[model samples]
Target: MILILVDALRRDHVGTYGYHQPTTPFIDELGARGVVFEDALSQAPQTLNSTASLFTSRHFPLLLWGVEHDPIPGVADDRREQWARTPRLAAANLTVAEVLSAAGYQTVALFNNPHQHATSGFSQGFDSARLLDRDAGQAYARVDSLTTAFLDWHSGRDPERAYFAYLHLMEPHNPYRPPAEYQALFPPGSGRHLYANGPPPPGFTGSDLETMTALYDAEIRFLDDGLRRLVGELELRTDLEKTLIIITADHGDELLDHGGLGHGKTVELELLRIPMIMTGGPVGPHAGTRVEALVRNIDLAPTIVEMAGLDEPGDFQGRSLVPLIDGAEPAIEPPEISYAWIAELRSLTSAEWHCMRDLANGRLTLYHRSEDPRGTLDVAGERPEIAELCLAALDRLEAEGEEARRTAEALKTVETDGAITPENAAVLEQLKALGYVEE
Candidate 1:
């Protein structure tokens, strides 16, 4: 199984998602041969929380905020030590790698995202795991290096053994700087200064937004070319038909949408909506199929586990998508609820509407997604019934998540004291440099 996770990749920016720009031709072609989920969302808008949920098949709040005891009760909220006290994925939780590895599949991971590095407990189940250097600067580990590492690692492995390889590409992230060739793909302009120090300067004009977006698109194109090369290597080295390939993003980015330059600050659609496409290996006859039902990133791990003919872990909160891939109705319909949590902001999205709550200020806003996909129009006052229903749903979800979290905590044999090691300090420094964690 090959899982390729692109960081901060917006769904609408891709060609398959109806964007006019040809930024992702390789991904578009892959979508044509796979099943596409029309509405897929990440559990959180930030990499740390979202990627944790993706691997554990649990919500971010449950993972980070659902501990039995607060590790540092008196520390300031902005302090690094306070954030370090947040819970990591428990050792008891069965990860996708652990399940596959137990089933005799070789598990490997090459991740560029700092949050998924070894210090975060994300490397628990992988037989081999590598993280890019903290000082790699804006581009981090480029796709070329990532692909080369995967190819080299796979070359030494036994060809007959089933294997699962995960690649997290960090291109197209903030401080977007495409190659010289790709920089010329868009109209030449100097927008680098706008986002060089994080976010466009105050009093930024609409034209400035356009220029910055063009730079981001160029980065996308550059990554697209790199993906094409990687796919070529896959075809040359392995049987494409037998390998399960999954392409998706950890979360999406916001470029002046909802008045933000980046993610993790808001639960707008642009930040939560992600692209998910699956092809090969257990997809069966569902080629070129698009399922309109809502899916979450948490569902991917369980689906991959089931596809590998292993039993889904009992603690997994997500259901398998194999039934949908086989052209049959899922025994249980996809849940109407999709959730996103970032610090004090909590969002719940339904089929036609979205509701967000600010836990700090008790502010509530609702958007009719069918009429306003961009979530610019606030209709909370106009549709009080819908808002009330969504709030009730959010309450129920939080209650259930908290209950499950406590259960998991009780099952732990060893309690974590939240001590920071040298490795964790290095990881924190990298995340702060990348603008994911605030210093």
Candidate 2:
């Protein structure tokens, strides 16, 4: 099985997802031959937390609030302190990679996201985990190079083996420097205030949004071309049909939809919704069909396990998605999609009402999707009872989340004095450039 995570890919940017551009033609083509999940959501709005939830099959509260890089206040003394220990796995959350590895599948992960650093506990089940690093701040090429190398390594292995490959690409991420050729092919310039190259254009608007989106689309096309080549190569291989393949994103990017340059702090549609599609192997039907039923990243592990015909762990909160893939209306009750912005918790009902509850203080915001799809208009004051219902759900989720955090923390073994050393500084600097941290 191959799970390819396209970093920072927004759901609406692809042709299959109603994007007018032909930027993601390859992925769009794949969707035609596979089950395309239309309403897949990320557990958290950020990469590290979302990845943790996906791998462990747990929600935000069940996993640690922050990974080794994005540390919450007082959680650890320093960055090094966070990295020095073997992290805890959420109770009853077993990585899909672990399950596959134990079932005679060789699992390898080729990741470029710094959040996937070994210290983050995301490397738990893989037989080989490699990180993409760079010189002179250019790293996307490193990801492509490493991915190609990893594929070559696996391809050279025994042909009879069934393996799971996780390719993590950080294109369309920030440092929005798509190659010169590609930059010319799309709308010009990174839209938001420039963090690196220079000052951003003034009076950004929907047109600028389209322009920046064009550049991002260019990057997506870059990835698409590469992935198409990879797929073509695999088609020539002996076990193409036997190998399962899944392509999705860790999370989406918000191009200033809610006054944010890059992702990490928003639950807006542009940030939380991502693409999830499966091709090849044991993935069931609904081929070429879109399933709009709400699903979250936490469900990935359970889904993979169920696809493999293994019993899901009892305590996992995420339900398997096999039924949806099999072209049936989802048999499982849809869970409310929840997200967090620092200490504030937010949730959305499958029916369309979205709610936010501030944990640091008592405040509630509610929006009815039918009326305010962009989340521009707040209807909390207009509907007190509905707001209360959403707030109550958020409160319950947060309470449960707090307990999960405590449990995961309890599993940790303290190791360092919590100081950020030179090595830690290097990593943090990369994260900062990636908009994962502020200087």
Candidate 3:
């Protein structure tokens, strides 16, 4: 099975999701052949925390942000003494890959996102957790090339082997530099042009929106081409009849939506809602059926394990997608989606409301999703019950998550210097370029 992660892909930007541009013809086609999540949400706004939850099937607050030797408060940290004592895989946590490996599936991870690298302890269970080709700083760079190469390599290997591969592609993330040929869609004064040139130019204008959107669309096209290639290759060699393929993203990016450029710093829907598609085996051809029920990033790991016919480890916070894939009505109630923004915003969400508390200060902003889907208007004063429920959920999830973090930390023996490693230096560079990091 092949799992492709398209980093920072906005749900609204794709044609299937109603964007005017032909930004995602390939993905739209994929949607026609698979189930499409209309209201999928990420566990965190950023890649590191969200993906940690994805790999471990745990809540973001409980996963310690994918750094070295840190633990989720209440999980599995108490077993070890120092951070260094923690292996890439901690005692209590088991990645989907590890369980599949034991079940005799060859597991491989080829990532464009550096946080999925071994140094961050995310590569724990894969048989060949290769980081693939990347500069120390542009680890996520050229993700398409890496995906294609990995597929080629996999195809040449034993065809009879049951295998699982996780591939991450960063085509739509910022420093939005598609090739010059693709850039032709945008003029020099456009936001996409300006972003490619360097940072946001002074006094950004709305007139540039079209060109900026065009450039962004062009980048999405590039990734789409690569995705098509990978899918075609998979169809040719794999047991496409029974093999399961899942495609989704860590989060979405905001192109001047609510005045934001990148993700991880905002609680806005533009950055939170991602695309989740599961196609393969018996789940294929369930296409174009939009599932309005909310799904979280935490669900990926558990779903993967269940698909591989393995038992899910207890303590996983996500629900398996098996029932949904089987077209079974959801038996359990939907989860209350929660996100923490240490960068600037802290928020929790339920099916009815989105409540954000500024991390910079304690000012609160509440939007009733039932009343204002655009989130253009704040109604914290108008709806006290909604606000109360969101806050209470936030408080409960946060307390549990914090406890997990503490437990993980207490079990580890290592200390991180707060400096970026050579492997993560490229991620730091992109974060700075996206204005997620300063100085």
Candidate 4:
């Protein structure tokens, strides 16, 4: 089984998702040969928060780790302490990798994102997990290097045992500089000077935004090509009759959609809605089918477990998506909840309404799901009762999530690695270069 996660990949930018440009031919082909999710939302709008849920089958807010969005008021004052407070995948949470490993599969995770390095507990259940080949200071590691790394591992692993490898690609993230050859579809031209590392570019005009969008699209194209190469190599090395391939994004990027260039700032559709595709194994029976029902990122873990014929484990909060692909409804559906730490925002998207509230300022925005899915037309004032109900639901979820987090943290108190250390300076440097920290 191979799980591919592209960082900062927007849902609407892919060819399969209705984007006019042909940025994802490879992924689109995967969708055609498998099951596609038309309405999938990430639990959080950033990598660490988003991926923690992906591994543990828990909502972002419900995770035991510190919510970095505001848990620490002065992030820059002490980088070491900040790293100490870094949102983590607590050991208390049972990860899908652990489940698969115990069930006789060799698990491996290769990623470029510094936040996902073992320090955050992201490496929990894998036989081998490491942050692969990234260059210094905002330079992305080539996708080829990552594939090579995986191949190195595959070549040495036990041939008879099944394998589960998770690869997290960073091409779609910031510093969007795909090689010139990859940019042939959308040349940089005059907008090459724009920097996408931090917040929105100052004095950014309409034309600059267009250039940013093109660069991002080109990045996706580069990612797609690398993915095709990696899959081809795997097919050659081993039999693929029982292979299971899953593709998804940690979260979507914000490209001036809500006045920002990076993510972690909001829970808008651009940041929360991601493409989830599954192919091979049991999914082969449902080829070329698209499931239109709403699904949360948390459901992915449970789905993988179910495919392995394992029952749900450790208070898993999501239902397996296998039922949806099989054209059957689940016993119970989870509410659609999306969250962001930076904005202190929490949202609930239901069949009838899409609601968002900025908890920091108590500002609420509600929209009719079918009529105004983009949430452009605010109807909070016109439909006060519905908005109130949404707010109450949001409040309840937050309360429950907080309590869950507390329990997780309490369980983690037994671990001895909580001390602050000077090595965290390097982590802060990586975070700054990656635009997680402001100057």
Candidate 5:
């Protein structure tokens, strides 16, 4: 099983997703040969928080904030407490890698982002998990080096053992510098900004937006080329009929879609909507199919587990998407809810409307998705019934998440404490340099 997650990849930017640009030819072909979920929503808009939810099949509060922080063994008390408050993947959380490892699979995480360091609990279950540093500035690791590293690792591992490799690439992220050739694909006029330092400057102009979009698409193309290389190599090495390759993203970037230039800020559709495609191997019958039923990134863990024919853990909250992959209808019409704890923002998406709620001030913003996809207009006052329904669902979700968190806290097993280590300081530098955090 090969699961790859591209950081900050917008769903609409892909060619298969109806974007006019050819930003993702490889991804489009992969989707055409796979089962694509038309409305796959992420659990959060940030990497750490969203990926935590992805690996655990849980909601936001349970995965992000509700876990208790403890002191690290080697770190000082006062300094560690503040760093402890940083979001983490708690040991009490059971990861998909851990389950796969226990099932005799060689689980490896050849990742890119600095946010996924060993101290962050992002490496909990993998037999070998480390940050691949074929550095691409703000984009971190180049997908090419990461793919090469995976091939090397696979060649050395026992071939008889079933393996599960999780590769996280940090491309199409920020400081959008694709390879020179790909960068030339969408050469911008000298008048507009191309986001050299980090994100687009505040109050950026419309020309700047177009320029940034071009740069973003070029970065996406760079990643797509890497995907083509990886797939080609994988096909040469493994049997195409027995290789299960899954591709998705943690979250998407904001490019003035809703008056923003970065993510971890809102649960807007542009930020939450991601591509979840399962191709090759067991997806044979359902290949080239598309499922319009709404799904969340949280379902990924369960789906992977089900594909492996393993029993789902009791704490796993998401239902297996295997039925949907097999052309069966979803068991329920669950609302897609995403949380942005940094912004204290949450959104509930249904078939009819999309609702964003600011938890701090209790303000509800409603948007008719079909009418106003960008969500520029707030119809909360005009459509009280829909807003009320969305708010009620969010309330229930929060309650459930809180209760689950409390249970985990009371009956926790592992002891992963936070510390302000030298490594963490370096990681903070990377995240800050990449516009992921404040100074």
Candidate 6:
């Protein structure tokens, strides 16, 4: 199985998702031969928390929401101490990698995102996990570099053994800098600098936003080119028909949608709705199928386990999607629940509505998804009934998360002692260059 995760890649930006731009020709081709989920969402809007859920098949602890330097009431003042106290995937939780490894499959991972590095407890189940080095001199490693590394690794693997390889590409994240050729593809004047140093300046014109979006689209196009090459190589070197290839994003970015410059700040549709395409392997029967049902990232691991014909761990919170893909009704309808947190803001999303509450001030803003997909129009005052329903759902989800946290705490698997070390100077510099951190 091969899993490709692109960082900060919004679904609407791709051609398959109805965008006019030819930003994802290769991905669109993959969609043609695979199942395209119209309403797939990440569990969280941030990488660390969302990926933690993906790897462990459990909801990330709500207590660690803003522990990364952002102050939380009644929490430790020191950021490092907060990280130490933050719950990680316990040894008790069997990761997809560990399960597959035990089942005689080689599990490997190549990621450019620093949040998935070894120190983050994301390397738990992999036989080999390689993160992009800070010395690579770029915030996002080039797609070619990652593809080359993967091809090299696969070259040495045993041909008869089944393998699970994950590739996390960091293109299209931030500081949008596509190659010169791709930059030239856009209109000359449309490439003018916008928010090159910081957030979009006040009084920024619509043209400026357009230019920024053009740059982001170009980044996607660049990555698509690399994917074309990589896919071609895979077909030539291996049996493409039997390989389960899943392409998705860790989370989508907010390109001024809801007036935000980046993600993890809001639970807007653009941030939560990600692209998910599954092709080959057990999904062959579902080729060219588009499932409109809501799917969550947590379902990925269990689906893979089911596809590999292995027994899923009992603690997995997500249901397998194989039945849905194979034209059978799901045994249990998934709950219409999606949760997101950043600092003092928390949002609960359902298929038709989104409700956000500011924990610091107890402010509530509700949006009807069908009427206000961008989440700009607030209807909480006009539609009290919908607002109350959303709030009630949020309350239930929070209670469930609290119960899960208590269980994890009882396992005593959380790292609670100086887990967050001083930032590596090189990694810190790359994050700054990508505009993820302030110098």
Best by TM-score: 4
Residue 95 of model 6 has an lDDT of 80
Return the clash pairs for model 4, or none. none
Candidate number with the higher TM-score (2 or 4): 4
- What do the candidate models score in CA lDDT, each in turn? 0.78, 0.68, 0.68, 0.77, 0.77, 0.75
lDDT score, candidate 1: 0.78
lDDT of 2 by residue, 269-371 (tens): 6777789888777753456667777787777778888877777876467778877777675544554464544336465545376666555566677778678
Worst 10 residues of 4 by lDDT: 67-76
lDDT of 5 by residue, 164-194 (tens): 9999988888767777798688775443654
Candidate 4 wrong stretches, greater than 4 Å: 60-85, 136-138, 192-199, 330-343, 417-439
> Clash totals for all models, in order?
0, 1, 23, 0, 0, 0
Angstrom error of the Cα, residue 288, model 4: value is: 0.5
Question: What does the lDDT read for residue 230 in candidate 2?
Answer: 81
* Better structure of 1 and 2 per TM-score: 1
Off by over 4 Å in 6: 61-90, 134-137, 188-199, 330-335, 403-439
TM-score of each: 0.86, 0.82, 0.82, 0.87, 0.85, 0.84
- lDDT, candidate 4, residue 421? 42
- Tens-digit lDDT track for model 6 on 1-439? 9989888899999889999988999999999999998888887777877777777777753232222332332222443364444444555456888889999998899877766545555667899987765324565568998888899989999899999998988888887878889978754244344553224567777777777788888999999999999889999998898999999897887767666567777666788889999999988778899887778888899999999999998767877888778768643445556676655667877777788888678778988888878788888999999778777766776778666554444333223322322433444344447443344
Candidate 5 — which pairs collide?
Answer: none
How would you encode candidate 4's per-residue C-alpha lDDT over 1-439 as one tens digit per residue?
Answer: 8888899898999889999998999999999999999888888888888888888777743243553322222123344364556666666567889899999999999877767755667888999998764554445566788899999999999999988899988988887887788778877556643655346667787777777788888999998999899888988987664789999998888777666678887777778889999988889989998988888888888999999888778657777898889988643355554443433788787656778889888999988978976667889999999999988988887887766554444434333334334544454455447443345
For residue 165, what is the lDDT in candidate 3?
86
The alpha-carbon lDDT assigned to residue 383 of candidate 4 equals 98
